[model samples]
Target: MAALQTPKFVYMNGGLTAWEDARLHIGCESVTRGLSIFEGIKGYWQPDGSFALLMLRLHFARLKRSAMLLHIPFEHDFDEFSAAIFELMTALVEPSRDMWIRTTLYVVEGHWGENTRSDLVLTAYHQDKALPEPVSLGISTWRQPGDDSLPARIKASANYQNSRMARIEAREQGLDDMVMLNQAGRVAEASTAALMMVRDGVISTPPASESTLESLTADFCEQLAIDRGYRFERRPIDRTELLIADELAIGGTLNEITPVKAIGRRELATDTGMLATLRSDYFASVRGGKPHPFAELTTLPKVSA
Candidate 1:
């Protein structure tokens, strides 16, 4: 894949401004201490010369909750933020290409344990690509901590260190990614996605209590399964289940319903039966290729200047 160039303009601090000129102090806690909250959002180009963000409301709600959990002292009207994002897409991103949009809030002042000022940056760039092929996964020895250790549901920048460690280990093991277990030794989520396993026609995933992040993509897949009259549930998944399951799939803003071809040397089926239908429906919904039930969730309201 070619490198994606950042657009000349981005929404920063409350306005559509020049990207190169945006700055944050090096000594700020958000920069020095990694105290930042963010969201990963995707938009698909439609045939009507427009792009629609997937689950814009849900993403914005999660971003706000993450900021509050981290004590970043952040506040923003959702409508305003949504409008800003829409405006950025209109100005910087082309309507014919898929795009990834990110909104991050950071603390710009004070030391640890002190209240600080906050700043925001929203960016959009082209990300036209297909979902990845089935990947091989390795079970990481590193354990995902419980919510008491850190806010499990929030998408905080510091929390990704756990995933980063597992990712590095997976690379060393010659695998595509790693799945970390919870403190209870049960399967948690993959690095940045939620995991779902199929066994005897039943699809189940570990609950959020198992330290899985609240994943919008996972929710979408679960809804798709229900709407399609498939059996799906959220429950605890044992570590051994991964090796024995008939099929496994993962979902997130980046992965978007990718299947697992093998787990450490145990090869599994892919693009067959339920997993195949889920994958097909997922891409169709995100890319405007089918009648998507969640299309309204992606539509941004018209913003007047």
Candidate 2:
């Protein structure tokens, strides 16, 4: 993972605040019980010196849904959320640098099992554009929690404990990342991304029903695949199938579309250029090189005097 470039300012609650001054009480539910939900958004610095946010509405909609699911009482509408993000970017980020932005809604003042007040915090930092690289993966012993338990679909802070454990296991095993399985012992996703495999010229990924988070980046890749006349399917992926797959990749806001070079000791075939093609298309769309529905750009708002 790339280190974040610390910003001079951040948007907290409703206004701009110094990065050092943005704080939460130690006793808050968000701190004690991990009662927070968040969305990761990417911003591209166009060649013309303007910033464009990728899929702004889709991310915010998911953020709203996450708050609703967790009962975080996120009352801010889409417009207000967009305004705050733009304002923060205008104040904190250089216009020529690409950035990664995180918008989090956390329980600010309540104990467990009580209706809580929530606070919004938006943070953005410099992020450089990089293409996905091949990495090794291990099948984790840690299984993803089912919807009946701590669901994997919610982008909540508490849910990441599962990912944290899996990542630790992977590191100890000397692998780049871990592929988590759902309750049914089927492939769920990578620790922080949605996994996709290619076999027989067809692209396949485990469905959201299989306990994977509904990923915007994965969806964008699927659309690009379809437009390029490649067949795409969503189904349960078995462990054995991964070992012999022709190609494998993982996609997310941060991972983008990373190719998996190996699963355990078995190296996947690299001759197939499908992952490369899709990744190129994805970057192009995000940078406004290609026109697509999901890549609709949101420019910075005008600053008021």
Candidate 3:
């Protein structure tokens, strides 16, 4: 029989508990109301065999911000959360080829109109041994919800249903992933990332106002474009712009710089595509927590700013 692969430890309310032991009854506020904030963090193995929890400080900051936006107050001490995360990572007797951690904060056991008190769940686990390589995506029938119509900016659990179903529909039709435009018919983003295009040396992205999730990865894309001596514009993007752009990429926690090889019948340029370049740049610095924070937006150095 193949060896068991499930992760064993998870940080629950206050301490580390066995993964199978971490459970909540059905009525938890986070479950019932979908009222939870989370960040997906990746850690890179350093040259010395130690791993740098790349962007540790940044992910926690975003988590805090999402919590605040959801009216679930948190007294976040970034330094402490950093220590906890690393401590949990260190406890692993057998770290995988790489690690991905879903660090989350939510209200415990309650429902509509219930007082929200926070609980934390931090789980670190192994993913498929293969590192992320560029993959294709499709145009999801789903449209991005407007900011007021939905809590579009927060990394709340409630929002993933849209992307989840989008991905499902795409695969059911035999595509990789899906891109979703906003209600305005403006190209908003992919199911879980920010989408951008490259054409005639200019980089273009849908404006955040179109209801794309405010993303750290998107900020990284902008910084990378400036460093690479490319131009950038964020405006309402026409759906056709994506189809005809010279290159296309999507940036997010797990799908950073995923390419759109073909959207329906339109094939993107394979030469020096935006996704290919971003694929190299995004992980190069962020993998081991290198570069200045301004230069490498995904990783740490969230010091005092």
Candidate 4:
């Protein structure tokens, strides 16, 4: 895993600023009550040695939508936010660096039912670490809430506590990660990533309506599958589906395409599978080694090193 080494700069509140200078009051409602929404985005090093942010437009859209859902009162328009992020990415001395960016909007001055003040904080860091492949997984006892209970599509910081608990339990169980189910006893998603499985050469996953977060990576994979003539479907998945899946993998910005080697002694074939092919192609697309339609919208030209 990549350890955070504080970068020299950050964009906080209203402008580009010093990283160390950004601060939040200890007693602020957003800080104390977990009233915030954020997005995690990955930027890759292109073959031309310039950096290209993966799915930048989609990520910004989600961030704004999440803010709206949570009533965080984010004021900047998409163009403004995009320009700020592009400026930050170009300011890096190493243009070929792979990096992670997080943009957050939260309430800072509200109590209970009072009027709230909001702010934005953007922090980015070099992401040189590569996660290990063929990760082990365990099913968590924690059930993810459906949309009726909470907005499952919003990227709210408070919503992550559910995943955190599942992660803790997975650690205790000697697993790399955990899979969560929805209230209807249907497979939802992994703690931090979207889940996909293969059975009889067909790729299938639970739909977002089944309480899974709308996953950009998963959607990308689905399109990739369709374009390449591979079978893919979005439908309700049950717990028993995991046991019978011929192959399994998780998708996310950070996790990317990680094959599941085993799930509670039910070993999965990972050496040669459809997921392996998709993973390679996905990585190539992100790094600009292959043609991907989304790249045109997702990447911005680096103006300076």
Candidate 5:
């Protein structure tokens, strides 16, 4: 296939190479019809010139599921995948710089209509910028697609169109970001991240049953919070109750646990709010290795290379 007129990229078609120079047929199903899946992974740096991955294993596990659904066999070795990510992240994340990583899987080639092919790609990008602070949000005038409707479970390239439409509408309306609702009109998630609401000293997020992607960072935050003795609950959330909640956070790989101050017309109480310490602790864990989780949950190993 003729290459895209873009800058150089590190692409792995079973082996890593400069993607712009890699060879693939135009009939590659993944390229021709978006027959691929991908994941976004993030890592951050510490004062010691080292870096840490946020929810690494969780992201890979999700990637495997995405591959299975697309029938794109993920043939790479696990340890190799981990090492590649480490090497790639270390190369991409400047020492003491915050970063984000993106991994992709695609089909090399097949019949125009056939769905099964085995080709893979990985790309990681980041800047020294800090994670976006939770800013004021606009309740989306748009809604999210149901899980059954679009294989919302798979992080397909196409899913973002839905998210894009909502986000564009929100931005045009002069909003920072918008919270999209499910077909049920129940509060689902923000166009980019998962939604959380605090009530009565508890941090609550809507269940995955309510979202397309069971967000990895959000789940990790909830688990870490619970392990630290904070009560974290997952349940179907009601739309009206969002306004009265003590605090709200949109959780994701990059967004982390930034808190929200308001929704639509109802002004959510921000000052004298209860989630300050929890938020601090979460940032600490993400930006440094001091409070690493007790168990080996991520593909990242105990010893750094």
Candidate 6:
């Protein structure tokens, strides 16, 4: 894939700013302490010369929950934030390609222990929808932070250090990604996505209680499976279970649906028809080929011809 082009504009603190000029102080808590909450929303290009933001409301809802959990002050309500997102998309998004819109709420001033002001930043760039080939995964030595420590439920920037370390370990091992287990020795998730295992036609995934992010994409796919008459279960999965599963995959907003060809050195059956069907159905649903029950399609304003 080619490198992504930077967007010309970014929405910052209730107004539009040139991307190069959007900046914060070097000593800001967000910079020094990684104190920020964020969300990745995909905007699918439609045939009508517009783009539709998938799960816009749900992403914002998760952002709000993250803010509350982390004690970050978010002054703008849903309507205000939604309007700002649309404004940003209008300025940066094009109908010819899909885009990944990222919104971040971060501390702008003050030290770690003090009350700090927060700013909202929204930026977007084009993204390709093509799915990559099935990947190999290895279990990382790093364990996901439990709720008692740094909770994985909140989309905080600080939580990514754990993911980053595991990803680096995977790269060193010549694997695509790593599956992180919780402190309790159960499967948590992949470096940046939720893990799912299929066996005997049953789709199983670890619940949010298992030190994993409450993934919107994972939930959407689970719903798709249930609607298609596939039995879906959310429970603690053992490490050995992944090695013997009929199929494995990871799901996220960025990684829509990715099949796992192997775990560690053990290669599993990757030719299952179930994974392909889910991947196809997922892309179709997001691109408006079918109705989406959970996410409301917020269409961007049409650009003048």
Misplaced by over 4 Å in model 4 are 1-3, 93-96, 112-114, 129-132, 295-305
How well does model 6 score by local distance difference test? 0.86
Candidate 5 per-residue lDDT over residues 110-169, each given as its tens digit = 665364667656676655546455567777777778877765677887677778888888
CA lDDT, every prediction? Answer: 0.82, 0.85, 0.73, 0.83, 0.69, 0.86
Give the per-residue lDDT digits (tens) of candidate 4, residues 1-305.
Answer: 45668888887767778888878999887779988888888877677666677887888888888877777677788788888787776665365457888888868887873777888777888865365478899889999997977767998887788899999999999999999999999899999999999998999988989998899999899988877789999999989889888999999988889999998889988868888888888887887889688644356554534
Query: Which runs in model 2 stand beyond 4 Å of their true positions?
Result: 1-4, 269-272, 302-305
Instruction: Rank candidates by TM-score, best first.
Output: 6, 2, 4, 1, 3, 5
Give the Cα RMSD of candidate 1. Answer: 2.6
lDDT of 6 by residue, 211-296 (tens): 99999988898888877888889999998898888889999988878889888888876656676678788877888788668756
How do the residues 1-305 of candidate 3 rate in per-residue lDDT, one tens digit apiece? 24756687888777788878988767778777777889988765544445666566667878888887888867658766866676666665244466678888878855564566787778887654364555577888898788886767788888888989998998898877788988888788888888888877788887779888777777778888788777888878888777777888777777656666777777765436655776677667755435546532322222111
Q: Which tens-of-lDDT digit does each residue in 190-250 have in candidate 2?
A: 9999999988888999998898998888888889998899998999999888888888998
Cα-lDDT of candidate 3 = 0.73
Against the true structure, candidate 6 reaches a TM-score of 0.94
TM-score of each: 0.92, 0.94, 0.88, 0.92, 0.84, 0.94
Better of 4 and 6 by lDDT: 6
- Candidate 6 regions exceeding 4 Å error are 1-4, 269-271
Query: What is the lDDT, from 0 to 100, of the residue 230 in candidate 2?
Result: 91
Worst lDDT 10-window in candidate 1: 296-305
Please write out the lDDT profile of model 1 over residues 102-157, one tens digit for every residue.
88887888777586788788887776565678999999988888899865698988
Better of 1 and 3 by lDDT: 1
lDDT of 1 at 48: 51
TM-score of 4: 0.92
